[model samples]
Target: MVDDTLLETRHLTKEFAGFVAVNDVSLRVRRGTIHALIGPNGAGKTTVFNLLTRFLPATHGQILYRGEDITHARPAEVARRGLVRSFQISAVFPNLTVLENVRVALQRKLGTSFHFWQSERSLDALDERATELLAQVDLASHRELLAVELPYGRKRALELATTLALEPELLLLDEPTQGMGHEDVGRVTALIQRVARDRTVLMVEHNLSVVADLSHVITVLARGSVLAEGPYADISRDRQVLEAYIGSAEPEAAV
Candidate 1:
């Protein structure tokens, strides 16, 4: 079947011991759109991401990617199918230069024979592509710095560049701007927007402005279930959503 939906979850549920983290939650992400998942703390947003990426097995339910059930797929299997995730913390090798980090990711995608044993000149073959990815993430100037030496925002950019090197069809971003200042947030937001031009992005983001600006669809989760789903304007005005945020006894900020 020619599926217009890039991703879907059917009655997805997750329970730890006797406690349910995600309870019969379902989602549909259309191809070529930025989808945002927003919620208060303990809302099971991270658990949903883990289930989709196969980091955690669902207590019950199914996950479909491009119409195929990925409920039992391995993390590597999902990633090979072009579903990649960028973590809240940067995922670059702290000791490696920004350029080298991207080069390594490109190598993983290429799977060259005896890749680790290949000469520096052979590895140089990936430099051009790595350079382009770095530029895309606005890390071109920091390409030579060790990943750990770069500023927090730039480290995130480098992680993004590495992820981009893999050319994922569906990108799962966890808090793309979690700890950034205003300037870095704007920079990362622009970078994400630019990258989503040709790919589908499903992001778990807290910043309402970023969510409102980038998402074509927004799904709000409260108490581990979908409370509302729509565009920013519609979801923003939802009475249930407003009440859910307001009712959070844990003092969470929500949009």
Candidate 2:
């Protein structure tokens, strides 16, 4: 792997029974850049995510992170090594206050054991860092609200805060703007751009506008294979990409 590459997948393949979901895919994510994986639904975008995060084991191929092969690393192990995935839904604990959700994640990152009997002061030490994370995602104002009470956009912001608390070197986001209103989409788009400044982000986003705006590189997948790969402008013009979305809502590739 090149020093500039944060992640690479070599001949990455996944099979379910006899179906090949991702077939011999090789990907390189440059350090400190935002890369997007876009395709029409069922193009194996999420399956690729599952393989990378080890949510599902790859049938074949290798996953390399920071030049180290982690093909067989467990999900927790991958997360511990600084590759973290944000689920499709916000992963915040609904009953916990926004501040507490981030605090708990920070504690987990620090390898602090849960101690029901521990003094409150130990947890208080986390407030400063947690507040900083919340501020990073523009959730500082809602720190006192329960996670369940946040509006959809704010809840997603809270989820991003918790993900950031892990201090991941590589972040995988699944449909960050899905189900969001236009206003919320713009906000999260800006938030993603801000957080990705110092880390590598690989995201699967259905919103082509957001992908075009934020992606330094875009890879288009079709039928479990890479159909096109390049800057947003170039991939947008690829004839193969346009045809792949023909009968469905177009990918807005021209964006």
Against the reference, the lDDT scores of all candidates come to 0.90, 0.91
CA shift of 166, model 2, Å: 0.3
lDDT per residue (tens digit) for residues 67-169 in model 2: 9999999999999999999989888899999999999898885567577687868899899999999999998998999999999999999999999988999
- Candidate 1 residue spans exceeding 4 A from truth: 1-3, 247-254
- Residue-level error in angstroms, candidate 2, position 114: 2.5
Model 1, range 1-255, lDDT digits (tens) per residue? 766899999999999989999999999999999999999888999999999999999999999999999999999999999999999877789999999999888987678735567678988888999989998988888889888898899888888898988889999999989888999999999999999999999999988889999999999998899999999999988999898788554422555
Displacement of the residue 154 alpha carbon in candidate 2, Å: 0.6
By summed lDDT, which 10 consecutive residues of candidate 2 come out lowest? 246-255
